[model samples]
Target: MSPSHLLALRPPPDIEAQVVAFREAHGVRDAAAVPHVTVKARSGLDDHLCWLALVPAVAAATPPVPVELIAPRVFPNGSALHLPARSPGAVQLHLDLLDALRPTRRFGYEGPHMTPHLTLALGRRDVNLDALLDAARLAFPQPLTFTATDLVWMRKPGPGGAYQPVEGWTLGSTPDP
Candidate 1:
C-alpha cells in the first residue's frame, strides 16, 4: 500500500520531550514517536496537488495557533489516552484546510467536531483506563500551554511505518522547500 499522509502541529521541543517521557513511562507502543496534535488524519490525499496548492494560502491567512492541553482523558471505547487541547485557532485552521481541499475523499476525522489532542497512548486496548488516567493526572498536574507555529506534512511508509516529516509551513508565512 502507498504511504499515508497527515497534517499535524509539532509542539516546541521542550513540550515534545515532556510528552515523549510521559508516553515512555506509560508504556505506549509509539513511545519514541513525535508528539503531535493531528490536524488531519492519515489518508491517501489523492488530490495531493490540491492540498499543496491550498495550504500556503490558508496558512498565510492564519496566525500561530494557541494550543492548550487541558487534561488527560480516555476515549469512550476505553482505549487511547490523550491530552485534550482547546485551540480555537487550530480548529479554524482545520476547517479552512477541509474546505480548501474540497471534493477529495474526506479521510479520518474532520469538521468542527474534531478534538485536537496530544496522543499519549493510541489504540492500546489492553491498558487499564482508570490507572492510565490517574497516572496522567499525576504526571500533568497543570495544563500545558504552547503555540503551534508550524504545520507539518507527515508521511508514513506502509502500514506500520513511522510518520516522518515531508515538509512544513510556518503559520502566516510561506512554506519551505
Candidate 2:
C-alpha cells in the first residue's frame, strides 16, 4: 500500500519529554510516536507531486502559530487521552490544508470539527481514565506554551505502521513582497 500521509505540528523537545514521561509513568506510551498536534488527519495522498507542490505554498503563506496546550482529557469514548491545544493560527492552517488537498482528504476532523490536540495515549484497554487524568495534571500543572514554527509531513507505510516524518517546512519563511 502507498504510505498514508498527514501534517502535524511537533511540540518542542522539553514539552515533548514531559508528555512522554507522563505516558511512560502510566505505561501507555507508544514509543514509536512523536508527540504532536494533528493539523490534518490521515489521508491517501500517495502521489509525491501532489503534496510537494501543495505544502510549500500553504506553509509559506501561513504564519508560525503560538500553541498553548491546556488541560489533558480523555475523549468521550475513553479510549484515548490528549492535551488540547488552543491556537487560532493552527486552526486556520488546518482549514487551508483541507481546501488545498481536497482530492486526497479522507478524514473529516477539520474546520468546525477540528480540535487541535496532542495525543498522549491511544487504543489502550482497561485503563483508569480518572487516574490518568490526575497524573497528566500533575505532570503538566499549567499550560505548556510554544511557537509552532514548522509543519512536518508524516507517513505510515501501512495499517499499524509507525508514522515517521518524511519532510518539513518552516512556516511564514517566504520573503516579503
Candidate 3:
C-alpha cells in the first residue's frame, strides 16, 4: 500500500469477544457485520458518546475533521457533510462507520439519524445507556485499528444469542495519514 492507500483492519480479539458476549446476553440478532462505537448520553448533550467499534464504509469516510480538504457541512451542507461532531481519533472512525451503514429514509427528514452507535447487546430492553457509556470510556485510550471493508447481515441466535462470522462484503479502504 502507498502512503495514500488505506488498509482495512480487524478489531482486536478482546474487543470482538466482549461484543460477542454482549450480543449473547441480550439475545440479539441481525447485527451489521461492521463495527461501531456504542454511544451513550454525555454530560451536557442529551446525546451519547460514540463508543469503540468499527463499521463498513458504505462510502468512504470523511477525514478526521482536522485533516480534510473540504469539510462537509454539519447541517446546511446536505450529503457533502462528512460527519457530525466526533470525539476525534478512533471515536471519529466509529462515527464514520455508523454514517456509512445508517438506514436511509424516503420522502421524509432526509437526514441521518444521530443514533450512531454499535449495538452491544441486542434484543434487551433493560439497558442503562449511562452505564454502557462509562464502561466504554474506561476502556478508552485503547489504541486499536481495523479496516471495515465489508458489511454483513450477521445471524446470531435469538434471546441471549450467538453471532456467527456471517457473510461480509468489501467497503473500500481508509488510510490514516
Candidate 4:
C-alpha cells in the first residue's frame, strides 16, 4: 500500500531544538524528528494524486500565518503532549485546502473542530505523565510567536514508516529568501 500524506508547518529552528531536547530528555525514540503543526491529515491516498491536489490548493491558500505557541496540553487520554497554538490564518488555509481537495480526500476534514498544535511527544500509559507535564510547564512557560511561512507535504512509504518530506510550498506572496 502507498503511504499517506499530510500538510504541516514546521517550527522555527530555535523552538524546534528545544522540542528535540525535551523529547530526548524524556527518552522518546524519534527525538530528532522535525517539530511541526499538522494542518491537514489525509489518509489512503497515493503521492501522485496528493501532489496533484495540493498544487492548486496551495496556490489558493492564505499568506504566512502568525502563530503563537501557548502552554502545553495533553490529549484527553494523556497519550500525547503538545503545545497549543492560536492561528486563525492556519485554520483558514486548512479549510481552503479541504474545499479544494474534497473530491480526492478519503477522510472527512476536522473543519471547525480543528485544534492547532505542535506535538512534543507521545507517551505510554505506564509513564509518569505528571512529571512530564510538570517539566513541560517549566520548559514552556512563555508563549512563542513566529510566522508559519511554508506548507510541507510529507509521506511515509508504508505503515510504521517515518514520514519524509516530499515537497513544500511557500505561504505568502514573497518566496523564501
Better of 1 and 4 by TM-score: 1
Q: What lDDT tens digits, residue by residue, belong to model 3 across residues 1-177?
A: 111111122344665665556445544343322333322111111112121123333323433212111211223322211112233433454345434434332223222444223433322245443454344444332433333434333333443443334434344445223
Q: In candidate 4, what residue range of length 10 has the lowest lDDT sum?
A: 51-60
- Give one digit per residue, the lDDT tens place, for model 4 in 1-37: 6666777888889988998898788776532156888
Q: Model 1, which residues run further than 4 Å from truth?
A: 47-50, 175-177
Pairs of colliding residues, candidate 2: none
Each prediction's Cα lDDT score?
Answer: 0.78, 0.79, 0.33, 0.73
User: What would the TM-scores of all predictions be?
Assistant: 0.87, 0.86, 0.35, 0.83
On TM-score, the candidate that comes out on top is 1
Model 2: per-residue Cα lDDT over 21-113, one tens digit each: 887778874523678888987663564655567877889989899999998888887756788999988899898887887754455556756
Pairs that clash in candidate 4: none
TM-score quality measure for candidate 2 = 0.86
Flag regions of model 4 displaced more than 4 Å.
30-32, 48-53, 56-60, 103-109, 125-128, 174-177
